[model samples]
Target: MIPSLKNILIVCLLLAALPACKPKTAGPLPPQIDYGQDTCDACGMVIDQPRFAAATLLVNGEYLKFDDVGEMLAYHMNHPEAQVAAWFVHDYLSEEWILGETTKFVKSPTIQTPMAGGIVAFADQAQAEAFAAERNGKLFTLDEMRAQVHMVEHP
Candidate 1:
């Protein structure tokens, strides 16, 4: 009915080792974004748009959510040391989450995005082309986002 000293010590050691039990570098963690209540991990602005949301899984197994993909980019640009495990963005057309690096992007002043970045993502080049054609926008690859991100105003 009573616990022994040896049992207590064992339990304490197990509790302390629990942190070490987490998987390391086996795979990237999934990104989590809370629609309205979540603040942009980069600029501390509330993420209100379901259309322009972005999030990334850091190498440390932490998630950084953003109101705009531009905010996410600005953070990475400013903090070049950030270890990003995976990048994700919401498709402006579908509001669906997709891998950021593989997705096509368009920058248009006609499209009003959070942070005034005016950048949008699409899962396919055709989609990006169609969107850009209708809006007179320019298309870019993920690697090119770093350059367009300069258009976003930093907080």
Candidate 2:
């Protein structure tokens, strides 16, 4: 028995739709920030600030862009749906992306963020200390920062 003409067309349509239904693997993240344009994955805000921008690279190479380091931390703390392979944040002074795990974060009311997160990233601990000295901010590791964000959300 031969397949009907309508059945063949339906099969072709189904085949074409399969790829669209599958989760696509994204390419590497952009090397630099596109301030005032990139949308935050956590809060849906525009990432217009360089110093406060943050992102997490998923294991599949997809990125979850954020407007603030604290927002990123809060998202990671609250969301258990996805695991991040790596994380990046902008340095307050340089406005360049740095490894979030290796960077030090300073959180103070004086260090204002886009979302009022009051978090800043620094490449050097001394620089963080200096920033803290300048504003009485407390320096924290990424883990510590995550915990602090968790506390705020959970408590």
Candidate 3:
């Protein structure tokens, strides 16, 4: 039997709404920070330096901005139970947001970060190595930075 016109329109409308019912997937990119206006979620300091900015994306889609990479590490370390969807950091040279897991890190006392964290991120390993060598800094991976922060907090 053929459906009535009203029933056919209802079916068409339901089909049109189906896509909107699908679960929304979060994007892999990090959220933009309002530099000089956005305050760090950890230290409450203004995030004026794009090169030194860091952020954590929670599973709930909350973006926690930080003034320094070390501050981001420390925040996560303290909130060990927080569900983190992703971590992001700005490339020291380009000031572009990069996946923290794929970025290289350098830590040195003389690096002079915003919060004196002395941590900077690089999108290129060779560049990170060169920066480390030039400033007597040590190279680290994302896990190493987290571990370093954990040690400092726990000890």
C-alpha RMSD of candidate 2: 10.6
Each prediction's whole-model lDDT (CA):
0.83, 0.84, 0.89
- Clash pairs, candidate 3, are none
Which candidate leads in lDDT?
Answer: 3
**Candidate 3 residues 12-107, lDDT tens each?**
999999999999975687888988899988778899989999999899888899998988888787887777999999999999999999999999
TM-score of each: 0.76, 0.75, 0.79
Angstrom error of the Cα, residue 40, model 3: value is 0.5
**Candidate 2 structure quality by residue, lDDT tens digits, 1-155:** 99999999999999999989988765345345577887888777788878788998888767888888888888887876668888898889998888888899999998778888899999988998999999988999988888888523422
Q: Which is superior by TM-score, 2 or 3?
A: 3
Error of 2 at 155 (Å): 19
Question: What number of backbone clashes does candidate 3 have, counting pairs of residues 3 or more apart or in separate chains?
Answer: 0
lDDT of 1: 0.83
Per-residue alpha-carbon lDDT of candidate 1 for residues 30-145, written as tens digits (9 for 90 to 100):
46667778898777888988779988888887788889877888888887777888888888889988888789999899988878778889998898999999999999888898
Clashing pairs in 2: 36-48
Clashes of each: 0, 1, 0
TM-score, structure 1 vs. true: 0.76
Candidate 1 wrongly placed segments (more than 4 Å)? 1-29, 151-155
